[model samples]
Target: MTTYAKIIVNGSPITKSNFKLHNINGRAILPSNSGKYHDRYALYEQEIALIARNQNPDIVLEESLIAILKVYYKSEKRHPDTINITKSIFDGIEKSGLIINDAQITRIIVEEYYDKQNPRFELELFGESEYEINYSINKKSIIDNPKLYFPIKKNILKRDSDKNIDKNINSNKNTVTNKNICAICNNEIKTKDYMTADGGKTLICKKCFNKLF
Candidate 1:
């Protein structure tokens, strides 16, 4: 008997015959060509890689959920928006016998999008207590789903506080350095030099300072 691990994407079961796996340096790698929705599946592969590299077990299942979401999005092409995408991903993972808590999954999605510098999709995972997750293309259906929205007002506040703390720390670091040399320009800092608000500080040589200032 040959033993093979079953791969499930977005609530759909994928078999070894339909997918190809390669081992690179002891890591399991799934080729982008193994699935019809190669683009989305590739994202899944990347997510899995990130989870493994980070050693985050909490998000391992969520990564799988994302894989399924990509597959579903490729097929449905509409409805439920990002929230629904998350819900459907969770549902599919649950049905696949993966053990994961709903709240945990929600937290992961919230952080992933929140931390992304340039997100491809805009999803306000934190909002009203209730909203719809429409799986249909109809705008009316999306407007009607009550459970689509997850209340994340508190999470947003926390993120703000975290940002403020980081800003303060960076500001203090710059103040202590007191080097006004423009990081972009190769200049030296003198005792009487002044640094600007930006990382570049004015390290005006007495001549340049007298000329410019």
Candidate 2:
């Protein structure tokens, strides 16, 4: 089952069914909100700031409940309320460990309003792709012998050999041939029988080849 995390902003909890936590350096932050994830501007800005400050991020997995609050009163128009909410959210993000420099804010507007039943909000922050988490297991305790839990050294070596062979075959296939011409220099190639140095069709002349090499 996918893990979730609880998001807390300005001492208030944000409810969400599936929570994914990201740790920027040592700081922990949330990616998605629970229920109808409406506050896009606030979340995106905060994420950007975090990415700017921290180069390496450590991810945390957990389950969380989020309560989304409306910025404006029910009777009031949404425009003013949205502005206020965005401002407040930005303020909260600034104080929530993410440091924003003098960079200009880039905003993306979502036309459709967020609905709990029919929500249409989908905005992902730009950063490095997520990686899988690997757990270190103790093999000696789990099995009668530690060797039984892991593949034999010979088997591992054989697999590596097979992989290397495949790689060599692929590299040979991709190597440039003598018949191909160089895209940069329109020179006739001397070697047409053998494979070119680049594994592409040989097109570069001796002078061009010397310059490139």
- Among the numbered candidates, top TM-score falls to 2
Candidate 1 lDDT over 79-189, as tens digits, reads 234443454334333433333444533323321222123222222222112322334344573455463645545543334422112222356456433233422233554
TM-score of each: 0.20, 0.20
What does the lDDT read for residue 132 in candidate 2?
A: 27
- lDDT measured at residue 85 in model 1 versus the true structure, 0 to 100: 44
TM-score of 1: 0.20
1-213 in candidate 2: lDDT tens per residue?
Answer: 222212222212222212222222323233223212323434655653354234323332222212233322222222222433433343433433332311212322322243333321222222113322234547574556332334435643334422112222346568533233433354334453222321222223444434432
**Model 2: residue 23 alpha-carbon error in angstroms:** 37
User: How many residue pairs clash in each candidate at the backbone level?
Assistant: 6, 25
